[model samples]
Target: MTLRSTLTTLAAATLLALLPHTAQAAEPYPDPRPITGQEIIHDPTVSRLKSGGYVAYSTGGIIGARLSEDGRHWTDAGNAFAEPPAWWYEYNDKADPWAPDLSRRDGRYWLYYSVSSWGSNHSAIGVATSRTGLPGTWTDHGKVFTSETTDTWNAIDPAIIRADGKLWMSFGSYWTGIRMVELNPKTGKAIPGAQVHHLATRPDAPYAVEGPYILKHGRHYYLFASYDACCQGVNSTYKIKVGRSTSVTGPYIDSTGKPMLEGGGDLVLEGHGRYIGTGGESVFRDRGKDVLAYHYYDAEDSGTPKLGLNTLRWTKDGWPVVL
Candidate 1:
């Protein structure tokens, strides 16, 4: 295996303990040392590269890159990937290539991102391939799935899960709910005959629910997603929610046996203290359980949206409580 694969094993050793589920929320985790070269980057996806180097990428509206040696302390921030497709700009004017999911498979790095405005159905998911996962080296594959201006939910926040030897992607929000499609391994394209499922939606959810990430525990495929507003300062209402299914294209259910397809979500994290708007999550299941990585308005400082990392533990009763 490579360095990233080795460090992924090391990260698994650092899994956090599962705790009780409470709506009142947490007492805050003690500050850990800053993982360097990762300054100002938000919405982080952590994984090991073939070079054995740890690579993390995020949506600063553009891809940001950093290297981690011990999988904790990182080196300087490196080059972000290039924006894909020439016509992607026709819809999005300001270059909001956000929320990149970096996956290393078959000796290449696949960069998937949402290219569009927020909260609108006029969004699309696109792919670009890079041999080295370096700066400006992506080979664009154009659009993967489009959810723009239709009855369909918005298509963004792409995450690829490999199961039973097939590649699948989970994406959607807005009028279009969270959904999934099978992917072609060689071309990184959706298999033409694939169908999209309406995973979850909440018209009364207080706000739009977006940002879906998947993890595995025991026999279930865990669907972890953020709900409500993401970028508000003091009034931010973001929270993490979860559901699970036996398969990736899920009719995922929550702790109450309520289906996520019907908008029932188990609360995982919410704002407390000076920290507000605590969701926009991408969960990392390093060792055993899950650890969450997202951005929040800092409680103490300027209340600026800063990077937040915490562990999500399963109670003895089998529900995830974010700490």
Candidate 2:
């Protein structure tokens, strides 16, 4: 080769090395990985264990739970409660619980679960704590907050978050979207003087937003919620949506700059192919990345609800994407 050509090649290589390299963008909404062993769960929440295992709880009788030695393989850990709390029988006919939130704090596991009946606003959120977080060791703390028939919000799908030096819970369902309230850190119940704050809602009849799980990323508190009709098997139109705000109690807005109170949300995950009706999401940090966990109807498996997990990607503009 000519000396001039060799010099040109070296210069080009040096320039290429000096320029920053960027990885290829991940596929949007990449298919969730299959979870092995006893995987039926609705409105699931997962927490990483100190022993490097994972424990998950979901909506069911006595709050069904599963434990995983590795994040991939799971075994039935039984129910968080042996039987439903007696107070729950007043609201729900079957006395079954739904949408349990699991978290660990100060060397103990704190679980917040919702007890309510179908198509009714008479509901209550309850707390239970356990030293080991394993099945059956939890000591029930009874009802934390309850709603009467006159109330506009249904107190279900409890999620606890510690932000701004206080413990707060965000919960609600179809009646009036999602709501938040400050909680007594020591008792894990609502603070006496603090008032309930409204978050997101759809004004249309039979409002469809629910399952409020908040995750703080950088300067924003992102609210992840399920939208549309849930629980109809394959016919379910459920999907996941998100909004963010600088404050924990939000006037949460979407990427388009529309407030969530006006029915604005950025789509995170929805049905694709056999992964139908993807909703009931919770975000958990594993290793260094955020993992989005939920349940999807398996079109290939008789439309049964099963576990779904995916890595969450954030855009430079500060929005969450499932990848």
Candidate 3:
């Protein structure tokens, strides 16, 4: 080749090397904007509707709801129900709901939420459906699963996902770690004959793990859970941790190759500055980015629990890291 052509090719290659390459998946997680209007939401989960609007459901009276046009600025969307379902009062004194998981299935929105009093294992997870993915429009489907005081596992903080052409749910807290159960796709309820699968937990004293959210990315199933004490505002110690496995029903392990059942997890996010105790995480794949939406106590805002959104990126090494 001519010297001039060879030099030109070398120069082009150098220029290409100098430019930053775009990532194949996940953006650098952004600092969440100060969302306004009824921003106090615990255990927040987001869903983008077909009409291009975003809906967030959380733990509170009538099951708190919030709406966002662009997934940043939010406004109160009212509650999912005008009154709590009759069955809820049986478990929770005031009938308040908690840790709602929202998803779209078969052209409809199904919300799985929990009902229980503080520090009690007597909890129930219920489903409510809506065609519009809005508050008020949801039709209650009563209790889909329940945990009695006699049970070893606390059945709250339920999350659902579709895998292998079937619906599956991961729900549990404190007592025996996380558990999964298959759901009948048509009914959005437990598949009667299917057995509940135990997934992860901290076997040590105080246990300290809950809020199971499973997502399928590439060839692995990522299980995200919260560790340490929550609900204490600025004093809260809650943080998000994760593990992964090839099978949806997993023996998930962290980056250190430690099994999650033995109290192992990779830290995803924790308190930084004004954001304290970030936990109750749910993953929402929006547009082309994976958004990790959760709630964190705002240290500066009288320790009020508020919505948090960050991009969940996967490292080239195949581990999830929050930016």
Best by TM-score: 2
- TM-scores of the models, in the order given: 0.82, 0.90, 0.89
lDDT of all predictions: 0.72, 0.88, 0.86
* Clashes by residue pair, model 2: none
* Cα lDDT of model 1 by residue, 164-222, tens digit: 78998888665635778889988888888787767777767433777888877767888
TM-score of 1: 0.82
Highest lDDT against the true fold, candidate? 2
Model 2 gets an lDDT of 0.88
For every model shown, the clashing-pair count is: 10, 0, 0
Q: Is candidate 1 or candidate 3 better by lDDT?
A: 3
TM-score-wise, the better of 2 and 3 is: 2
Regarding lDDT, does 2 or 3 come out ahead? 2
Task: Order the candidate numbers by TM-score, best to worst.
Answer: 2, 3, 1
**Which residue segments of model 3 deviate by more than 4 Å?**
1-30
Cα error, candidate 2, residue 59 (Å)? 0.9
Instruction: Answer with 1 or 2, whichever has the higher lDDT.
Output: 2
